[model samples]
Target: MPELPEVEYTARQLRALIVGAAIQEAHVFWTRTIGYPDWHDFCAEIVGRRIEGVRRRGKFLLLDLSGDFFLSIHRRMSGNLLLLSPGWQIDTSLRETDNAAWQTRGPTFLPPTATDVAYSRETSHCRVCFDLADGRRLLYTDPRKFGRMELWPCFSEAEALHGLGPEPLEDAFTVEHFAEELAKRKTVIKQVLLDQSVVAGVGNIYADEALFYAHIHPLRRANSLNASEIDALREGIISVLALGIEHGGTSFSDYRDLAGKAGNNFDHVRVFQQDGKPCVRCGTLIERRVIAQRSTHFCPTCQQLIAE
Candidate 1:
């Protein structure tokens, strides 16, 4: 699954290319991609609306439209967004084109072959496409089909986003906030960090990395931490997340940047997938275990199980 950093990267890339572009046409190849408002309503409502801006909240991408409507996309796993022009020739041999075409063409238009703008699937799993008036199209490709795209009124409340905990990178998520959230949970520290309601945007990869950085065991109870331990954990979480974003996110599986480029953060990971490798700090062998039904990687010698 593309976590916060990957989603944030995708949003940033989309914001740069799609903002101010009007939707000339809209197509929903997979009806299931739009979770709400029905497929017909989604197409009817989003067509002809200009993209005002693009933003991200947690793992959701929001494309603000001209009116009180926004396009929301959740790339659950194996999902990506690609921007292409009329001349774009997708390698249908390598990738499956879920849907393709121009939404609106200006008087002076570029030929499909001469446009020199192409967003190829490069792989067989391309799934959703959103055509814009500026001759550019936003495509959503997901091999597993676990992703979703939805349209809603601008005034619509994000019920799904409301209960999520504070963004770890925001000023609102201070050490005090982290401590408070942790104090309220009696679950294992790893489990608490993984809880979207406890702190949004954190996943197993980052949880493991943060715990390793803080020298906290995955099984440690959340409420057992002292003020100092809480502080360490807070810093660790922020540092790891910032690094992940700076490095374009980790690409352990099918995750890639908005342009379908691979991320480089996996090379910088300290312990997430380094099972049996030597720990960079203490020279101890990194270990992997199952916690909360997720694979966890850490150094047993570095992240002692003792409650701090």
Candidate 2:
């Protein structure tokens, strides 16, 4: 899934490129992923609208359009948005072209050998595509079919986003509020961090990283956090999220920037996916376990659970 950092990177980059651009064409390759009025009506409502702005709330990409309407796109898991520049050649091997071009995966690296070229030319997994008047095409690609797109009249009218928590990167996510939300449940700290209603956009990767940074074990109950521990956790969340954006979002899998380039944040991760490695600070062997049915990595020596 493209979490806060990855989705944030895409949202921030596309805002400058797509804002003010008219949607020359709107096409959906998979109707199952369209969480809107209807496929036919959605095209009718969005084709000519000018994109007023682009912003991100949690993991959702909000595209503000003219006529007070918006298109909310959730990248979900394994989904990415790629912008194709004018004169850019899509893969020639693709034949299912329509209003949206059936969005083939734009070539990542130029194929070197004969075997690689044949495979690169037939890239699929593009679920939607929007052609801008400037001749640029914005393609939404998802291999796992987990992402979704919704067309709405406005934010106030969208019922799906009624329960999102505060953005951790925002100033409004203070330590006091963090403690209050923590008290709302007595679950383990890792699950609390993963809960969208407690704090938006802190997924499995960041949850482990943040817990490690705060020196709090993932299995520790939320209410067990001391005042100092809560403060450290708050700082850890912000620090990791901000640093993630700076590093261009972690791309351990299908995540890519506007240009289909992999992010460098994965290289800078402290405990995420660095299992069986030495902890950066304590030099203890990092470990991995399953929490909330998700793989978690941390420094067992640094992040110790308190006996409750």
Candidate 3:
């Protein structure tokens, strides 16, 4: 899943590319990708509307369109939004996948040969394509089919986001508020951080990185965190997320910017997938364990668990 920083960077790049671009038409290859108003209605309503602004809430990319409509996209697992420059046309032959499309195992749902051509030409998972008035085409590609697109008249009407927690990078997510939220849960701190209702936009990657930086074990009970630990945890979350945005995003797999480029943040990760490697802060080898059904990486020496 593309978490907060990935979505935020995507929104910023999209805002710069398509804020004033008008939607001339839409080509829906997969109807299930539309979350609201049915595919037909969604396509009908979105045409002719100029994108006024682009922003993000949690992991959802939001676009303010003409006539007060809002467009929201959630890249659940392996979705990416690609924007192609003018003079580019879809190659019809690229739409057909090889017979071994499903037999091969890879990071993206796209065929193994997908890397040979420009991203825009690969239509294996291009679920939705939008033709802009300026001749550029925006493609929403999702190999796993877990992503979704919703068109709402207003931001509040999107029921999918009704219960999300506050954005961690926003002023509303303070240490006091984070501690208060943690106090209400007895589960492990990592699970609490992953809970969308506790702090929006944080997923497995950021959660692991935050715990490593805060010197807290993922197995530690949420309520066991003291004031200083809580403060450190809050700062850890903010700093790691900011750094992720600074590097574009963590592209361990699948994730790509509008230009089909991978993010550079993966080089800066401390413990997300650093299992068996020596810890950056200490020489002890980092370990990986499954907590709350997610792969968690941490340093045993640096992040010892409290007996509580």
Model 1 / residue 23 / CA error / Å: 1.4
Per-prediction CA RMSD (Å) = 5.3, 4.3, 3.9
* Runs with alpha carbons beyond 4 Å of true place in candidate 1: 89-123
Per-residue C-alpha lDDT of model 1 across residues 164-243, encoded as one tens digit per residue = 78888898788887888888888889999988877788888899999988999999999999898898988898899889
Better of 1 and 3 by lDDT: 3
For each candidate, give its TM-score against the true structure: 0.88, 0.89, 0.91
Q: Pick the candidate with the highest lDDT.
A: 3
Candidates sorted by lDDT, descending order? 3, 2, 1
Instruction: Order the numbered candidates by TM-score, best leading.
Output: 3, 2, 1
Residue 139 lDDT in candidate 2: 80
TM-score of model number 2? 0.89
**lDDT of predicted model 1:** 0.77
Residue pairs in collision within model 3 = none
Predicted model with the maximum TM-score: 3
Alpha carbon lDDT of each predicted model: 0.77, 0.82, 0.86
Error of 3 at 21 (Å): 0.4
Error of 1 at 188 (Å): 1.2
